[model samples]
Target: MSMINNAHPGSSLVLLNLIDRVLLRKNKLVSRTELLEVLRPELLPKLSPKKKKDDEVDEVDDSDGTAMRRFEWNLDFWLKEGLWLQDDAGMISVSSGATQRNLPERVLELIIDNAKSQTDQEILDEKNTEPFFRAMTCLLVQQSYTFMGGETVLPGKNGSAQKAVNRWLPGERSLNLSNELPTFLQYGDFLGFLEPFGSGYIVDPTRAIEPYLKVVFASESKLSLNIFIERLAEKLPLLDGGRFRRLLEPMMEELGWSPREVHQVSPSLSHALVRLESAFRLRLDQASDDNSSMQLQLPEGKHRFVSEVVYLSEVNA
Candidate 1:
């Protein structure tokens, strides 16, 4: 059996860490150091002034009527902002709900066009780019039923100095990674997802979001997506980004199935679906009493992304 299914489009905050700028070498672990560099600037003391003098007796001091104070500062405020790093190694890692590779925690979200092609025109279209970028973006904070309206609380610099580090990521800042964002996709790691979604359905969000990030810190590869399930699972939750998710309906028609059919029936949805001629040489194949050879596994219809896995030839037809 092909055993393919539409993926869920859940919401995710892909926090591209400004590890190079914000975080020092010590603070990079998600469990130990999330949001520290941005939200908790206090954790890292602001760079002090360097006083200089011509001679030892003429040394000039810029201290505020006192000597500079230094102490082991509390770093909880930085933890509120989501960070991406592997276990305890202290390197910036992309936060992941599933088993995914880690990237710098500096990205917010994504925007892209989904047109598949073998030429530059394909870059203009979102079809061939979805899987390319989807596989690149990672989850900084895992979406959970337990946490709805995300909130971050952290300890203060002092025992009684509690501070709520307001880290409201800008909608644009979170989606597009500044123009000229680099291409960060590792094809080997991202190809499996596109394997199922097909290269035609892939998209390169890097170009779409290139203009939205800080140009100085943007990536060259740009964010792109592929056909991985765990990554595709983040589609629905991103509805707030606007008209991106509505584009998934075509998959239903391509599968020789209708939204009404999937919505109306519950148990027989798999067998009830008509396979595309190109997908399976035979429209329907009997696998066993438990599972069918040709069946459509629809993602939960409550989100904002296309969650159907229809045959590609069906789409061309």
Candidate 2:
């Protein structure tokens, strides 16, 4: 198994118990409100005291009460760990494969394994590192690329990895999973897989991630854009140009980083279609030298760029 940065094994234990309680009540889906009520006594007592660190600023709403905020934070933990799924209905449920193994026994084992240092109370150190793992998974498995026994080049700064992870786990939006590149890089070195190279990191396939990818993706062929978009839309329902702007708005605000916004017009159906055509054209430019007809036609609108060539934005690409 890969080394999971689950420093809060105590919280995992609490969640396992919570899952059992919900299941015993013949409920598969538990709302945060209902779960928080039950979790107050069972799990809240185990949470470490909120450290008054000068650098750490709590973004949680003060009126939500400590217990409520903690419950939400714990839910964030489960979401990041990929143990639970929060749906559009604002309900939480066990993920499909989370219970494949004997969870009760597994939870017990985790408790036993980490029991020696459970009370050390060093903030557990990995409360937010889950994004790195999730992002790394997406980078490798979201598209198909064989590990040719060399360094794979990932673009952008270390912080960009968190953006990829946030996109990977779309529903849990309460916690900001940015500024996690350094922690991820440090952890990668400990795992003996990734190393610093230039502005990015050099990923060695044989070290760790490759073995995990080989088993997970299992496909040798690259995933086409159509399939990639479809699969991405499953997790991120708004994975289109229309809804994508709405999603990017909050992320940009939280990250304190802005991408140049060029809204030629409101992202209507016409704009979406135009964006789609541009995407395909951009892909064609990168793809193999096949002179196949793309069959792209301009939509019936004043926004049509039939006579004039429409340029694609590499920034958004």
Candidate 3:
């Protein structure tokens, strides 16, 4: 089953981090029973059923069966998804591909990367791409809305936005967008692609790309604006001109989304760069003689030009 179906957005990170910590502390593989024993206390409070005021009768189970069911669903999904590995003896440990360090941002990166690795065919067959598609759609919608000077609202379960996004899929597949949007938003927040705004989330991928800057730059301290964008797109294929973004472009165009002007960056990406520059993480420079400068479109219709980007290695920390 997909993460959207098996995992609750609020509880997924909590459970994942708990497992990572337990495994790290023990410095060895832990038995399934032992792992569950450790997780139950931390997980139950969040997953346990709550009494509704409208209920005519309240029958609470002493065994905490409902919580256990929710826990199992999440655990099973992680195990099958290769985030956590189980041995022949039922000994569990974090996946080797995951960063051993227990940083939240690192873990979120692992999740995002894993989701991105799934092929479209695999997603169509196994429905594992729901998380990726939902998160991408969320970011796209927010960015477009902001660019158009419209206030952002959470997509309604059966709203026109949801219907339009769902149309991105082929007739062979479909998503319950209303049902999956909350979890998608939660994941986006954790990944730093979206930030909490007035009433909902807004596109802000600066934090999201921070962890990958070194990976993208790879010892180079500076790059031409065009090269930096290329590397960033290679690292994160969901952004502007990325493989995933390209795949969605046809559908987006059908919905009246227009391409950015020549040498102009998309609003969301421009915002991210401007924020990074302001925070001293990077410096955007423009040469008087350089004709290849790119324009960063900022809020309130402001624009800044840059020909090169200097990634501050020390400041990224």
Residue-level error in angstroms, candidate 1, position 123: 26
Better of 2 and 3 by TM-score: 3
Predicted candidate 3 versus true structure: per-residue lDDT over 1-317, tens digit per residue: 44553235324555555567777777778887887787674345354433344321233553646656666666676676566778888888765535545354655555557757677655334555454554454355334444334445354443333443454554434445534555555666766777777666666777877777777778898899998988887767667666666666655667566667769877778888888888888889999999999998877777889999998866353
**Segments in model 1 whose C-alpha atoms lie over 4 Å from true places:** 1-24, 28-81, 84-101, 104-201, 204-287, 291-317
Compute the lDDT for candidate 1: 0.24
Please give the CA lDDT of all the candidate structures.
Answer: 0.24, 0.38, 0.63
Instruction: Report the poorest 10 consecutive residues by lDDT, candidate 1.
Output: 1-10
Determine the C-alpha RMSD for candidate 1 after optimal superposition of all C-alphas.
21.2
Query: lDDT tens string, model 2, 1-317?
Result: 11222233323334445554564454478787777667664445443333234322233333435544545655675454545567889777764434523453333223223323433222122233333333343333221111222333343343344454455445543123222333344444344334566655544322332112222223532333333333333332222232233444444445543332332222222233344444542222224553321222223323321222222343554
Model 1: per-residue lDDT, tens digit, 188-226? 113221111121112112222212222312332212212
RMSD per model, one decimal: 21.2, 17.1, 4.4
Top candidate, metric TM-score: 3
Q: Evaluate model 2: give its TM-score.
A: 0.27
TM-score of each: 0.20, 0.27, 0.80
Model 2: CA > 4 A from native: 1-27, 50-68, 76-83, 100-317
